[model samples]
Target: MAGRVAAVDCGTNSIRLLIADLVDGRLVEVDRRMTIVRLGQGVDASGAFAPEALERVFAAASDFAAVIRAAGVGRMRFVATSAARDVSNREVFRNGIEERVGIRPEIISGEEEAELSFRGATTSLDLPAPYLVTDIGGGSTELVLGDAGGVIAAESLDIGSVRLTERHVTTDPTSAVELAAITRDIDVLLDKTRVPLDEARAVVAVAGTATTVAAVALNLPEYDRDAVHRARLTADQLRDTTTWLTTSTRAARAAVHSIHPGRVDVIGAGALILQRLVDRLSVDSVLVSEHDILDGVALSLG
Candidate 1:
């Protein structure tokens, strides 16, 4: 069945939309875009969606709705993760999206989130099986161990860039105490993760955090999706980049052409999470994927 479909991934830090044509059991991209709304802003401490945050997300939803309509998408799925699951005022966020997009957003579980990430990331990769897929989002990080057949074990941890930054970051360049606090939290979550990291034959990292890191690693004068996507980055490269990001001032990070302004404040935390995972897995290199849960949701529409 050939059809035009759209998938909207409203995560903690950004809202992304993907409109694609489903033909012969594969997705052909029609449009793909992202907007940094920081929907999870203050949700960790406040335990509810902030009024300003809801407004930003609603505005993005309106824009995405227009795009979907323009593309004439026949089917669309909106999935909300992390912050949506933690917030008490979810109805406000949900009703706002439904009003603009004409479809209710599904607040998916962490396990399901991991599965979708794995599917979207591995579908186009010609890599070794038993691959470990990691999605470092704003509110949470999902670790999924799977192969060509399917997923084996997966876990979604609460340690994310926005969450960690909100909890333990105050200095300009981030003090040693702040970094240690963040690292400790990440280590604690990774320690409890049940997804056998040792079983992975290859590692594939997905979403904004991984791709942005890849862009810096490649030393791109600007953000280039083609160069970042599917690019292999060694462990040493990741470590050095992480070190530089965590130690650099906000002005220096903002000056980088590869780092998005929305991510400039928290990329260090995101990079640290990636670096810690790489060290834990002891992998020589990791393959970065631009296609992620958005692709997974689009595929599910078929």
Candidate 2:
């Protein structure tokens, strides 16, 4: 079956939209875009969406609405994660989107977010199982283990790039003290994943953090989805990248042709999370996938 659909993923740090055409069971991207709104800027401590965050998200929604309309999408779905889930004033966030886009955003559970990420990252690859899919977002991280039959186990951790950076890193070129604190927080959550990490034959990492890290590891002149997708980043590469990110100034990270301006401040924490996961899992390499929950959200529309 073939159809046209639009999918929107609103996370703590960014709002992304994917409009694609499903042709003979394959997804062809029509217009995939992202805007950093830092929706979860202070949600970790406040437990509410900041007024600025809400306005930024709504503005992006307004822009996405136009893109979605122009594409003539047959169906559309919006999935909000992490920051949206913990916020106390969700009604305001909900009403804003509903009014701007004419469609309400569904704040998905961590379990659901994990499943969708697994489905999207592994569907197009002929990788061995059980593949551990990791999606490091701004406010949380999702770990999903699955085989060809489908998801077998999934867990979401409360640690994320934005959350940890905001909580721990208070200075430019984060100090060792801050990095250590972030590491402790991540390690605690990683230990909580009762699923046997050793069972997975290979690992696949998805989302902005992973892709950005991959782009830097490859030393690409710029960010390219085709190059980053299915890219295998070795343990050494992860370690090296993490070191550079942790030790570099914010300007240095932002100067990287591959690093997005919005991710400059928090990418160091994100790299730490990925490196720790790689070290914890004892995997030789992690395969990066560009298709993640956003793609999975679009597929669900069919």
Candidate 3:
């Protein structure tokens, strides 16, 4: 654990960390953990971090600070994305985190976010042709089209499950009216963004949303990347899974044999986002990645 550099991703929905020691050509993971902090709950409406959201982030970061210290990790690279970069109160949150977590979270631009996600996604796969990379986070989703060497086109969408669920879908089952509005918005983005799916040989999805869905497909009791990563999922199966998830309450979803307890509440929105992407692109199957932006950050820093 000596000379380990820790990379922390303070995302709108989750705070993730990767402790690694570079070994020749590969990155070896020493420790990793994700905490659901929902830091962007109403930032889209209020144009600032909500009071409760700020509190959740501070409380969680304090704990992460302790873990980092316990692991004997000294050098750290921390970045915040989406909601943090969008809202004006980023400094306020950043000040609090530096005071409590002993680290000032750097706000990474959308381009950097897409790059890290792409780095994590493509490096984990063996792509035959260029692919469209999709990452669904809590506050934002990134859609990137790229080749083997670098990114070609990438855009970050403000539409995330947490934001969508808070703004539109209120009912336990998420009524059809709300669902329609969200779908219309997403469909329009897909059309307007002009992402070329016809040329893409495949689609790859990274981050918690895609990996969690893959886990459910494989019926894993715990989230295991070895089983979940690169798990092939179809558009039909994606739709079917989302339909099944929407029927249950948060408690019921958590009670399901496959779903993670911390992921149950927000997963409905994640599934919807994934399903829409799959449908719009006419994607028959997609590759899932357990590693995401955090892993890419570690790689980049090396």
Writing each residue's lDDT as its tens digit, candidate 2 over 207-282 gives: 9999999999999999998999999999999899999999999988888989989999999999899999889775
Top candidate by TM-score? 1
Against the true structure, candidate 2 has what lDDT?
Answer: 0.92
Looking at model 3, which ten-residue stretch has the lowest summed lDDT?
Answer: 190-199
Question: Which candidate, 2 or 3, would have the higher lDDT against the true structure?
Answer: 2
| Cα lDDT listed for each candidate | 0.94, 0.92, 0.80
Question: Estimated TM-score per prediction?
Answer: 0.99, 0.98, 0.93
What is the full ranking by lDDT, best candidate first? 1, 2, 3
Clashing pairs in 2: none
Instruction: Provide the lDDT at 31 for model 3.
Output: 90
Which candidate leads the pack in lDDT? Answer: 1
